[model samples]
Target: MRKNSIKNIRVNEEVHRELSNIIRGEIKDPRINPMTSVVAVEVAPDLKTAKAYISVLGDEQSQKDTLAGLRSAEGFIRVKLAKSINLRNTPEIKFILDQSIEYGVNMSKKIDDVTKDIKED
Candidate 1:
């Protein structure tokens, strides 16, 4: 199957949703911040591997801790995923820390500050 096939897209969405639910409700690791969110999920066409983009709404330490926590819980997460979703092969999840949301917010704040200065001038 092609990379952008309909089936592949559906799988990605299902994996994304299940992952979010598992992380948000199932996991009991204190290292993972309560503000953590799953930004996206990409499952390979073959379903052998997947990448989960995570975002933590906290300091750098919290982000690192969250990533570490997720990595440590990968096996458990995969088991949960397999049980929750009837996939042929449960993909090995690779957690990736995503800072896009934080970056966008920072950029927006900078832009607002510049605009305010312009108005004052």
Candidate 2:
């Protein structure tokens, strides 16, 4: 199948949803921050592997711990995903730290500060 075909898109979305649910509600690892979120999921068209972008709302230590927790629970998460989604192959998941949300927030704050300075002047 083509990379951006409808079927591939659907698979990516389904995997994304299931992964979010599993990470947010299913996993009970203490290392994982309660504020963790699955920002995005990209499943290969071949359905053999997936990259899950994860965002943790915490300090560097918490983010590291969260990533470690997720990595350790990958097999369990894959099992849960397989049970929930009917796919020919359950993709191997790779967790990636995504700071886009945090970056955006910081940028917005900087812009606001600049605007406020202009208003004061």
List RMSD in Å for every model shown: 0.6, 0.7
| 7-88 per-residue lDDT for model 2 (tens digits) | 9999999999999999999999999999999898889989999999999999999999999999999999999999999999
Stretches of candidate 2 off by over 4 Å are none
State the C-alpha lDDT per candidate.
0.95, 0.96
lDDT of 2 at 7: 96
Local accuracy of candidate 1 as per-residue lDDT tens digits, 3-112: 79999999999999999999999999999999999999999989999999999999999999999999999999999999999988999999999999999999999999
> lDDT: which candidate is best?
2
Q: State the weakest 10-residue window (summed lDDT) of model 1.
A: 1-10
In candidate 1, position 21 carries an lDDT of: 97
Each model's TM-score, in the order given?
0.98, 0.98
Model 1 lDDT at residue 6: 96
Count steric clashes of candidate 1: 0
Single out the weakest 10-residue window by summed lDDT for candidate 2: 37-46
